[model samples]
Target chain A: MAEQKQVARPLSPHLQIYKPMLTMMMSITHRITGVALYGGTLLVVWWLAAAAHSDAYFAVVQGFFGHWFGKLILFGFTWALVHHALGGIRHFIWDMGRGFKLPTVEWMVRANVIGSILITVLLWLIAYGVKS
Target chain B: MNEMSNASNMKTPLKRVRGFGASKTGTEHFWQQRATAVANLPLMAVLVWFLIAHFGATRAEVIASLQNPIIALLLIMALASACWHMRLGLQVVIEDYLHSHLAKFAALALNIAIATSFFAIAAYSILKMSFAP
Candidate 1:
């Protein structure tokens, strides 16, 4: 490990150097969730192509989605979707010249975080609550 | 009036344009992605409601719903818009996080290929369902 150590170059100013602020946190979270969204796309494709083919195929997907690991993945997907969706709305608002004020920006970040969780939980509850 | 207008624009229009910063293309791509997302907003709601209505139904039933002209068209539109949006988002992620320039370009190309393939496959599936007897 010591022999393999490489000299590092000056790094781009990242989240570390500055005191974390609400907008910074939201920006970072947006990128993180964007990465998660890639995996979510795979899940979407699986669900679609499985349903497109046959019952057995769809059942295979349904069975996996019914399992614990699958549930966890799906939970992450849901959270990513909701979080990214809200974050995009926040960006859109900023693009339109609203929600840039200090207090509003703080509230927006807090709202995005809280709202994403609440929506994800609500979705899971409804998913389990459904009859079929 | 001539002096006032001339003074208001001291620099030639070309000079003023040249004064603007580099790579207008990036902002155009960003705006296009936002436009697609705005379109997807309503389509997404429709998809959610459609799925809920057909939830847990058999594969045949779901396919039948997809075969509906309106639903098929909407699904294709949604999938295309989504893949485009995903491609743009992932490109930025690659550019930001990937350290090696070669690796960054590779990832960007791979992301585009995957998004294109996903869209193609989805369009094929929709056509198969919609057009097949």
Candidate 2:
């Protein structure tokens, strides 16, 4: 037979082909939140280093965190941490060969998101409540 | 069951399992990732709790909190496990997306360095604060 023509074929199952699902969103968010934790971790490390040096330095650090922008970032960081933690639990359960049922998976994903938001809000509420 | 026969057979489950096969490191990596994550659950909870409890604490107040042996110990453990888990997690991310060998190598190396040194700095601060006069 003659050599086959070298025609470039379009790839099937294109990137945007699939409809979005909760499970898919959860997987993506888990990774994105995991990476975001690094920034939050660095901020905490910086805070610790400053606290070690002197009260003056620590106060300067606190001032930044007290600002509206810093507070917003910290809130997001807390949410990320909470979301990732719950997602980690979901994986941990799967690693044990359980919770593979569709219903269970869907339930866990929903809890991972809703629980993180609730817990983070509760934490900040307690923080501000105690502050007053 | 002798080694000669086993070697000749080349059908042992162990041999079948390297590369994913004989080495078995793929599953080993998976287990380690989960282990660090499990360790993080409680340690991170404690760390978060400690932070909230000390949200606006002054230097002296904070130092006193760290000075408690149990608190410092938990903080150190939290940092160590967290950073270790962070390195493992990022390694997977780097390996997945970076198609180029050079890019993967650089990112993995940087991930390890940053994660390890982050724990060092964090733990040191906790210790120095705890031990100060």
Candidate 3:
């Protein structure tokens, strides 16, 4: 049998060590919104499946989406989807080896944040506007 | 003679490390992610448009709109690509944060199963609507 030795080691610096910056914040939001999109996609599946099942089932699903809480969730889902998509574009730009400069990265992060919210609101407004 | 014998007995470092080099699939994964991201750009726009058009529409109208061949095709493509992209993205997240081996494996498997089944269900529904009327 071999004996093991104990050693003291320093741990990697974590969230407490650093101030939050726009890029860092956006990166975290990107992961969160990605996960949220998974749930949102499931809702999309539910809606499609309900429609295929029957009109009654479809109406139930529609009614659920029409309710206040459901609308809130849908709103959140829309934001998540758009945010994640923009985050992905940012990632793609990085993959292409562009936008690595601090200013460019920060600008991209800000754009994603603003663009997602604006687009979501615009989409809902359009929906309501066309509806009425 | 001694040098020849040493050379024959010793393993070249490259030979020892060859199989362990890169996973060799990192590039493929990166490309797949980027490709799907690009595809999703247009597809997502189509999805938003379709949803907006169907908003407040009656059941019959909704079905009729989905029955459009172009709409059905685009919807399925968007959903399938989204599932693929989601699975790849989540897999990276799991690999990064899930330190437990068993937990990581379980999460990866669950991710695949969920994405696959969701895509299947959505695709089936779209196909049903397109053809069953």
Candidate 4:
């Protein structure tokens, strides 16, 4: 195949070629979280399946979620979810042909980073408060 | 460089090569991805809110929660869009990083299988709990 044929050519640079910046890292983080959510969504799906089975089944799943380790996973999942969601908003804004200015890009990245953390933390707090 | 103003045109390299114009798969994939994303942005918010409300909830309480037709409908909608979006997103990931043709094909197939089963399980569960329990 032509793709298998060796040829001398200038190729795309590795990620190391460019100096890392917050916005660039945020872009990568978006993809990373997107992949993580692929697995994370399974957890939520399992919860629904278990709940559908019976109360005993639901309790087992709920117990796992109550455990510290599961909580950690849930926390990571939620962080990824929020980060990716905000990242999507940034992408949507760009897709709309706005927010292209350098300063605006910087502002959007900063807001995404902070807002994801704040929203996730608030969600967990509310969850705990409701549970208590 | 070609003096044809091709660079300024809206056609992507793949689109120009394939000559399918607007019927190109990439455009459809992109539009669908965005459509699902727009749907998810709000549906996901409502989902998180519902989850928090039911956090650490028992089966009966969770059952009672799903008893509301509106909530069940919302969950089903969220599952449908999220599954579709996830499958499309993962397909792009596979297309980008997997250089081996066989591996890329396998991954894409697996992505579809996994996304489908996940949606099936969750949707069935929601329906079962909603109508019967």
Against the hidden reference, what TM-scores do the models get? 0.82, 0.90, 0.88, 0.89
Which lDDT tens digits does candidate 4 get at residues B71-125?
A: 9999999988999999999998998899998998899999999999999999999
Local accuracy of candidate 2 as per-residue lDDT tens digits, B7-126: 557676665555464445668777788888999999999998888887877888889999999999999999999898888888889988998989989998999999989999999999
Which portions of model 4 miss their true places by more than 4 Å? A1-12, B1-18, B21-26
Which candidate wins on lDDT?
4
Model 1 lDDT per residue over A10-118, tens place: 8888657899887887898898888787777777677777777778988898788768898788788878878888898888999999987889999999999999999
lDDT of 3 by residue, B1-133 (tens): 4332465567665565555546645367877878888999999889888888877678787778877899999999999999999999899899999999899999999999999999999999999888875
Query: Per-residue error at B43 for model 2, in Å?
Result: 0.6
Q: Candidate 3 falls in which docking quality class?
A: medium
Give lDDT tens digits, candidate 4, residues A22-123. 998998999999999998889989999999998888889999999999999999999999999999989999999999999999999999999999999999
Quality of candidate 3 docking, DockQ: 0.70
> Higher TM-score: candidate 1 or 2?
2
By TM-score, is 2 or 4 better?
A: 2
- Extract clashing residue pairs from model 4: none
Q: Count the backbone clashes (under 3 Å) in each candidate.
A: 0, 4, 0, 0
Ranking of candidates on TM-score, top first: 2, 4, 3, 1
Flag clash pairs in model 2. Answer: B17-B21, B18-B21, B18-B22, B18-B23
Q: Whole-model lDDT for model 4 versus the true structure?
A: 0.91
Ranking of models by DockQ? 4, 3, 2, 1
- Model 3 regions more than 4 Å off: A1-6, B1-24
- Give the candidate number with the greatest TM-score: 2
Off by over 4 Å in 2: A1-5, A8-14, B1-10, B18-24
